[model samples]
Target chain A: MTGLLDAAFVLLILTTLVLLGSSRIRLGIRVLAVQGVVVGAAALLLPNHHVTLRVVVIVLIGTILDAVVFPILLLRALRTARVERETDPPVGYTASILIGVGLLTACLWGMKYGGITLPHEGANPLELPVAAYTVLAGLFLIVARNNALNQILGYLMLENGIFLAGLSTAMEVPLLIEMGILLDVFIMVMVMGVALFHISRTFDSIEVGGMTALTDWPDQEDVGK
Target chain B: MIAGLILIPLVAAGAAFAIRSHPVRRAMLVSVAAVHAALTARLWVDWPARPAPVLDGWLAVDAPGLLFLSTCSALFLAAAVYAVGYHAREDVGEPRRDIEEGGLFFRNEPEAVFAGCMLLFLGSMTGVSLSQHLGLLWVGVEATTLATAPLIYYHRHHRSLEATWKYLLICSVGLALAMIGNFALAASIPRAEAESGRINLVLGDLLANARALNPAWAQIAFVFFLVGYGTKMGLAPLHTWLPDAHSEAPSLVSALMSGALLNCAFLGVLRGHQVCTAAGFPGFSSELLIWFGLLSMAVAAVFILGQTDFKRMLAYSSVEHMGILALAVGCGAAYGMGLHALGHSLIKGSLFLTSGILLAAYQTKNVTKIHNLLADYPVTGLLWLAGFLAITGAPPFSLFLSEFTVGKTLLDADRPVAAAAYLVLLGVIFLGMASAVLPMVHGTGPVDHEPAGGQSAPPGYRPPLTMLVPPIVLAGAVLGLGLYLPVDVREVLRDAAAALSGGVSP
Candidate 1:
């Protein structure tokens, strides 16, 4: 069971790396869906088969929503926007992948030096690496992606990493708290989506750079003048 | 009763959302504000005991909590009343309707929704001050951010939208990092103790077990908490979003943000300080706070000196005052620090409210334009000038008393160097702020010849009694605090300060 969890975690990190390296918006969403599935599988393989009914319900609901519904919604948004690929990624795909590799190395090195004891109920070594990789990948997406929609995807990836950290503890967070977190994230995405739609409509471009002109201190003067 | 103080605004917010008529919405807002102030005053008179109604150890009203709550409730009531008058004077068309052709902006009538969200924002801030559980406090803080986003975008101009987006995204990221810190704190608890499992991340619980917490993790957590909450508090290096948001927001909203919201964020940092002190890490936490405080003061001084927009300068002033408050607390002077927080809140609230009036009358936020404020609007201009003096810690103002107290406390503690540095920063800030503000207040530039917003105030363009009265009342309160601290209020400050200093005066 532990080996299965570790394999799933590694696969999740790979999917995250794929997300970081992809310029195609639709492909990135697909990678996120795959990553979400790995998280659900890892959750299932935890040593605590005595998991409370509430934990099961939360995992079930979160997995279904995150892995299936969220992906579909994101894909629909991409299709609506009709952007085939992310042109001029914030950082090139190669650099993002290199940064992910560095993050993964640092995670392993830190774990060795810190020598922090892992939780007894589950696999410990795999936990920190998974979290670090996912977090790095999320940051990559956020920094490299040009579209506001893709940034939201990165935020969700970062959240997934944090969720994995919580799962490593083998303690069931209260259902209400979990629900609150999920609801807040949902509302945040909805708000950002609306803002993105408005931005697109007004600027005639969904690119994040277009909004920079709205700042009081614009870098270029002659464009609008 | 503590719960009622928070719930009333929340219910009023919902009511405001349901009603469409501007008059009805405005009336609901005023009534709620009046009732909130009245209830808080009653609480003061009743002198509620310590730990009034602890909810599963998640919510409690102790001395410091009560002090902040009362101050916030008072300031919010004033801002709410003033908002009605300010809104009434403006044309009720869509805010983005006047954007230049080909400009990147969208306009909509979210005024009713905006008004409703402001009330909710007030409620959430109140919740932040009153909350005992760390989790509840986090919830309240995040809720304030969400509730106020619409209010920030109330103008719906392209610039306003950009400001709102930055405020939302950066603050949310900072807040999320704070949540990770919170989890770190929870994880640091010892597993051997039976009661530790039941520990609910309440401030009291964390403080009680501070000595047993993992010191390394606690230190990391404190750093994250400071950076995270400090971002919201508009501390330097992390305060890039503040001026833009404050400048673009409606004046009434700006007042609340500068006055009430920043203090709530400071409270979160103070909570972390309490935990760190109890955990035998006082020096570490204090040094970090002082570093950030001094940096914030320096940055504000520079920005204020070079500031072009009058509103942006005021925003920087807020940042400067927050720095002073942080420095006072960092000095480990309990009484002086408590007084500084109170004094700053009252005076800053008054200044922002008055600045709103000036902006409304002048029609432009540019510091160079619209001179002879006293001649144009005698009462408001005088109030604005007085507010400037009071905020800069001039003699005979409450801030002067508070700042002097901090200086004395530092000297008594044998920190002459820090005291000197603080004075220098304060002097620089004073000079910078005065250069920008004095011109607008006293210059002989042409009076605002045209009625602002193309609407002549009906027959008599005098500000409504609601808008004019609150600032005057607040100014009076500030003056009273400066000249003579009431016995009961003094006693409350003493107790609160004592609590902060861990019962040690030094």
Candidate 2:
């Protein structure tokens, strides 16, 4: 079980690296789907987790929504929006992969030397560090990428990271509350998809870099400094 | 009963979508708002006499919750009333030109979506106020973001679209971080508690056992909670989406966002603070809050100094007041913070509604282009001026009392340096806002300034009574509170303040 969990974590980390370096939206969604499944399965592999009907249902629902549902939604959105790939992200792919490596290294280093421990004494040590790395990677994806679909993918990755952390750390989260969290995530992704569709429709592009009409800075000519 | 308070609006939101008639939906909106307010008032009036039981420890109305809940209820009522007037003006067949993209035209989104989202926003905020479980509270906060995204996109234009996207994505990401914070909070439980296999997020349970919580995990939880909810609360460096969202949304929606939604987000932070305080860890959270607070104030002041759009200026002012709320709590003036939250909500809600009227009459949001307000529209002009005065901490308003209380509390706490900085920031914000507002309210427009909207309202047009009354009523309430916080209200505020700093978390 421990080996399985470690393998899942490795897969999660590697997929994040692939996501960071990839510009192809389809490939990104596929990688995210794989990552999501690994995270959902990793929930079951957490040490001391009681395998019950409710937990199984939640994990099943979570895995299906994250792996199959979200990807299909994004692919549909991608098709409708008529965008093929992420174009001209603020950060380059090679640099992004390097940054991902750096983020993973930092997390590993921090876990080793930073006196970090789970609330429960017997929980797996790899869970928190991997979770932290995935979260940072997700946030980096959102910030560094200019594409809306890519950002949504980043958001889902972030959600997956949080879900993993929640499963490991908050062992006693109520089944109903877990359902609520999953439902919220589902609605959030739907909302983002619709909003993305609207953005593409209105701006004729889904690039967030074009959103410059609203700002606080005084125009240069008006400031005349 | 608490469940009903949350469920009623949610059901009405569904009804709003199903209903065909626009007027019926609007009527239902107001009726729901009124009922929610009445029930909230009953919580104050009747429940104290015979205390109600918590619903399975999932939802409960404590002092701070009730206070914030009351504020939300009251503001929702005001915004609901104001929205009727707004839609009456806007929902016509007029193809309003998109101001951001010149020469492009747009129409309002479906009335069902707007009305449904409004009620849904109310429902979600109610959930936030009543939630006794941290996980439930996180759900409520995220639901609020989802509910209001459509409301922000009500105009169905590129700018509103962009604003909606930013609001949806940024807030959702922020809230995801908050979920991580929730996990960290759960992790703060002692191993003994964890071994019992009943590690729940019920506030009372956590508060009872806070002393045994792991300090390291508690610190981590507090950081994530602050950053996560702070982003939603419009603290500086994370407030990037606020101005755009507020300005793009309809004025009534902006009012609700500033006055109600932000307070609910702040309440999320306050809940985290309550837990940390119970766990004997106040210094860490307090220091971080004060820094974020000062940064928000400084950011607001700079933006307000150069703000061109009137609506965005009000949004920035909200960030400033949220900062004040944070600062007051950091300084241990929880009592004053309670009053400040109420006063700020009422005043800011009124100001945004008044800005709606201004937007209608002038067809422009630019401060310089809008002129002769006192001469052109005396009532709106007075309300506008009153909002400016009240919000800037002028005498004869509750904000004055609250701001003074907070400053005095800081001084009494032997934090003269912080007190001075607080005062200095307040002074700068006042000046900055006045420079923008006074001219807009009292100054003249350029000689060649012709109203720009393709279908501008006629000169000397007056807003209907429905629109004018809500702001006047809200502003009047703030004034009345400033003059004399009735015994019952003051008592409630005191209880709320105590709840913030109470030895046990409420």
Candidate 3:
């Protein structure tokens, strides 16, 4: 079980790096879906003394939402917005890949040196570090990408990272709360997808860089009349 | 009983969606708001003492929550009444021409969507106030973000679309971190407690087990909570979405966001602070809040200094008052924070409502272009001037009392320098806001006061009583509270403040 979990963690890291390096939105979505599936698998594989029917059911629903439902939504948005690839992110793909690797290394080092240890000694050692790396990489994706769709992808990565972090912890959140969290995430993605449609229609492009009509620069155009 | 408080509006929201007639939908909005307010008032009377946790300790009517809940309920009623008049002017069920896009026509979002979202927004805020479990509170806060996004996009223009996008994305991300904070908090439980399945994120359970918590994880949770909820609360450095959303959203939505939604988020932050205090780490959270509060105030002061747009300027003022709330809580002035929260909400809600009237009359938000407001619209202009005085902490308004409470606490704590900085920032903000507001209210009207291409007020336009009464009533409440807080209200404020301060002081 530990070996399978470690393999899942490795897959999560590889997928995150691939996501950072890929410019094709479609391909990026695929990598994110794979990462989501691995994360769901990891939730089950974690060494738990008691794994009930509830856990299995939640894992199934979560996998479907994160992997299948989310990607389908993003793909529909992609086709409707009529964009194929990220043309010019503020940060290049190579630098982004390097940055992802650096973040992964930093997370490993920090966990090892920072004396961060889970209460359950039998928990996999790699869980915390990998979760931290995924979170940072997700945040970096959000900041470095210019497309609204890419940012939404980044937000999903961030959410997935948080989910993994919970699995790493010893705490037992109630199933109801877990479901509430998942439902909130589901609605959130739907809202963002709808907003993306409006952005594309109103601006003729999904580049957030062009959506600079609202700003606080001292000399910006007056918004009054 | 508390479940009904949350369910009534949510169920009404579903009804609003199914209803066909716009007038009927609007009536539903107002009637539900009135019922919600009456129920909230009934809460005070029924539990004249203290109410126990309802729903298996998942929801409770505590001092701080009640204060916030009442404020939200009152403000929603005011916004609901004001919305009726505003929407009538807006010509619901008709495709409105886009003024920003040079005569291009854009259909307004369905009035049903607007009313439904507003009701949903109210229900979520109610959930936020009543939630005793951190996870439930987080759900409530996120729901508010979702419910209000459609409201902000009601106009269907590019700018509002942009505002809605920014608001939805930024707040969603921020609340995600807050979810992580909830996990961290669960992790902070002692191993024994975890093994016993006592790891739910309920406030009472967490506080009871505070001494056994791992301080390291507890502190980590507070940081996440501060950043996450602070982003929603419009604390500076994380307040990028605020001005745009507030300025661009229809003014009634702006009023609700500024007046009510921000308080719900602040309550989230304070809940985290309560846990930290129970965990014997008050100093850590206090230091962080004080610094963040000062930073927010400083940021608001700078932007407000020369702001030309009246709505954005009011948005910045909301940021500044949120700072004062944080600072007061940090200084252990819970009573003052409660008083200030009440005052600021009513004053700011009235101000935003009045700004809508001004917008209707002038068709412009630029303060420079608005002249002779007092001459043109006496009631709105008087309300605007009074709101300015109240918000800026002028004498005999609740804001003045609240600011003074914060200042006195700072001085009492031997933090003279912090106290001085607080005063200096307030002074600068007062000057900044006064310059913009006074000119708009009292400026002499030139021959061509209207901006180029600005449409004159709709022919024979007179401010409807519904539009005028809410602000007057809101501002009037602030004046009354400032002059004399009723004994029960004073007791509630003190209790709320004491709850936040861990009963250290009244």
B-chain TM-score for every candidate: 0.92, 0.96, 0.96
Give the count of colliding residue pairs in each prediction. Answer: 0, 0, 0
TM accuracy, model 1: 0.91
Error of 2 at A7 (Å): 1.9
Candidate 3 global TM-score: 0.96
Better of 1 and 2 by TM-score: 2
Candidate with top DockQ is: 3
| TM-score for all models, in order of appearance | 0.91, 0.96, 0.96
lDDT tens digits by residue: candidate 1, A2-36:
77877987898788778778888888888888887
The weakest ten consecutive residues by lDDT in model 3 chain B span B451-460
Displacement of the residue B481 alpha carbon in candidate 3, Å:
0.6
Q: What's the alpha carbon RMSD for model 3?
A: 2.2
The ten-residue window of minimal lDDT in model 1 chain B covers: B451-460
Q: For candidate 2, give the lDDT.
A: 0.86
How well is each residue in B404-439 modelled by candidate 1, as lDDT tens digits?
887787787787777788889899888888887787
